[model samples]
Target: MSNFNIFLKQGTCSYCNNSIVIQRKHSGENLCPECFQKNIEKNIYKTISKYEMLKSKDRIIVALSGGKDSISLLYNLNIIQNRTHNSKPIIALIIDEGIKEYREKSIKKAKEFCNKYNIEYKIISFKDKIGKTLDEIINMKRETPDYKYACNYCATIRRRLLNDGAKELGGNILAMGHNLTDFAETYLMNILYKRLDIIANQYFFKEENDEINQFYIKKISPLIRIPEEEIFLYANIKKLDYYPSHCPYREKDPIIRKRVLDFIQECKKYSPEIEFNLLNGFLELSKTLYYHRKKKNHSLCQKCGYPCGNGKICSYCSYLLEFS
Candidate 1:
């Protein structure tokens, strides 16, 4: 034998010794690539059942941004809803944040997915509703000292639109594509920002009352136990044609949300259970906040007739006035 061995070790799947890229344990099949996709869908169905997010009469409106998470949510919800014999069907609500590059691409993907699934879809634009798109508002505010960040504008507008749009479409609840990692990151961000009310409202699911229910739509996320990476993988394996670009504003954000995400990523290095622990943190913190803050009675927003606090104007209205 030669002193130096020149043979390269050919790698195979650890589970079955079949040549493959991924080696993780899965639910069925030889599970090279296509098989893993099926496993994710099955897992999503189980998660939905375990959480009881859906019901016989729920009209679920999926918030589809054409991103990996939203596409995965739409796909899985479409499958599970049909099997449950749910009376109310699921629809997709796509909100365009007015970024030409981001919104345009995402809208195409959203329309495509909806077409393939034969699901009802609607698109709401900032320009049509607010009289100005992000590009217009940014240009107007470019010379001003009070230039708001992209996420600040995008989040405020989208939240209001989805709630309003879902209600308009006769939806009983709004389903979002938020996963465990997203929830954990958001939870930490709220703590850093001292947004107690947000944390209180962001518990796993919220019950809709006549006051807030009329103004804001009830929301649920069945994928909270799934990780972000898994969502991406699931979407790809399902051959979901999702908008593959990130919002330009994300990198531009100098906010703590990004840092919080990084912190979660670092913690995940040692233990994959960090996300589940953080989710537990959210559950614990939400109960604490709910107990501390007295529930406020809501009235209709004079402008839109949605549920509002004692104030006649809602956050969406306040956001609109910010531009003026």
Candidate 2:
């Protein structure tokens, strides 16, 4: 046996006798390249179907960051949409955060992928919509009291822009690329901060009243069950053309997101199934909180008239006002 095959013999795939490419510690499944790819895609399909995240006629706006996760999501969604009769065309929405070298290169790759696949795409920029790029926002907010980290601004603005962009394109559902790692990290962060309202607001099965259904396009993350590294492996094994870089600010900022992610990784070393546990806990906690807080009325943002949770001004509007 060759050296590679010898390595494979140590842990052959659970599904087939092929060389093992991935060892899923969380589930204790050793998967080869082909089986691993299929498993990831199958999980994505299952996630969407279980959540009722999409409909045959629903227009999907894929939030393409040009990263591995988003690229994998867009590719899979395109394949699924193509096979479904009467499904609306999947549109790739690229948000340019204007992060100098980082976003520009990613946008280029995004455009290339869209062109190659003939997927219709739209590009929105922070400069055009918010009158300032993310870099500018960070610099401006540096000295202000209670100033949040770069990620705080970036995530809030990017979310609002993606929602509005999808709505503008006549989309009913917006698909995102947040993987299991992201979801688990965010859940832990919220728990650490005692942010029950945020958890309640994110209830997956919250009743969609007419008011909410009118203003908010339902958001779905099909890859929420898949880990981040698996997505990276899938992208590479599939020979996908995606930007292989992280945002510079992500590492530089002293943000809770990074710390929480690190903590989760550290915990995973000791307990392989920790992330899965966190995800399950988040689901139950969010559902319970949603029922308890269902009757609570959310105030509209004074400036934009959008649901602003407990605050009079929404975070989106607040950021815009501060930066403007």
Candidate 3:
């Protein structure tokens, strides 16, 4: 052997002595992989307990995008339930936007994970429900006057689809895998667009309203506190298999949403806790927003019978009528 000394790549937990390949920068722990997992799981448990997101018998339908954040959430929730044998079992709900190549791969991964966990998996396609796929919506919008951003149509339709799909599948609680970055971006977007009503409703928790309760599924975000970077890191650390590409339309959106996110990320170099601060601001403003939305609930949409403002038809009904 050569007379050279090599530094041991000591894979040891910063938090504990358990071996780990990764380390959490914020927590400053050389934690064993399991301990790192536990750290994130603790956040999920805290959120659930704080918000009371789930009830004993409430059927939960998770919005799994075949991404690491969602996979992590499903895995954690499963582990929690397995530990407690808690109220009702969880299911995964994936809405196919009908992006053949993108969705084909993602949906495959989603189904694979769901099957492995033995969790019930349900896929609702835009074509089946909306009579047109996302591609159709994009093309239609592109041709129309007063065109909306691509994300605008995609998000709106997807939101409606998620609510309806959850309801159709007997899902009282719809868990979304929106991480901290997503939440901050949404908050900033609302501020930019001056959509106070949406801002008010952006809180992680919400009290039920009769009109909304009638048509909408109760949505929750267990990954609300986890940073996007952390989720990406965790997924890589755990060797989680997920679709890696972004939606092609995302880059083409005319809106400033992505720019805002980029700014936030750049600011994070100077202050990593900026997202947390924004989250706090959102929570503080949400109470005022809740009262505002409740007061703003006006007439019902005549077309679909859902609540609508000054319009003859609700946004959902109008989009359907116009598109189909």
Best candidate (score: lDDT): 2
- TM-score winner: 2
Relative to the true structure, how large is the alpha-carbon lDDT of every model? 0.76, 0.89, 0.78
- Which residues of candidate 3, in runs, are more than 4 Å off? 1-14, 17-32
The residue pairs that clash in candidate 2, if any, are none
User: How does each model score on TM-score?
Assistant: 0.85, 0.95, 0.89
Stretches of candidate 2 off by over 4 Å are: 1-9
lDDT by residue for model 2 (1-324), tens: 011121233578999888898787788899988898899999999999998888899999999989989999999999999999988999999999989999999999999999999999999999999899999988888888978988899999998999999999999999999999899999999999999998988888777788877778888999999877788888887999999888999899888888898898889889988888988999899999989988888899999999987878999998888887
Model 1 Cα shift for residue 110 (angstroms): 1.1
- Candidate 3, residues 1-324: lDDT per residue as tens digits? 022112223678767776674544444556565776677778889988887887667788889889778888888777776666556788888989887588888889899898888999889888998889988887877867877767766787888888888888888888999999988998888898888877776655666677678977788888888888767766766677787667777777656888999888888778778898898899889877777666665688887776665778877777777787
Sort by lDDT, best first.
Answer: 2, 3, 1
Worst 10 residues of 1 by lDDT: 1-10
Estimate, for each residue in 1-324, the C-alpha lDDT of model 1 and write its tens digit: 122122222455434555543433222233345445666777777777776777778889999998888988998888777877636678899988789787898899899989989998999988888998987877777667877666777787888888888999999889999998898898888888888877877765455456555456778887887778767666665678888777877777586688888899888777768888888888888877765663655577787776655689876787688776
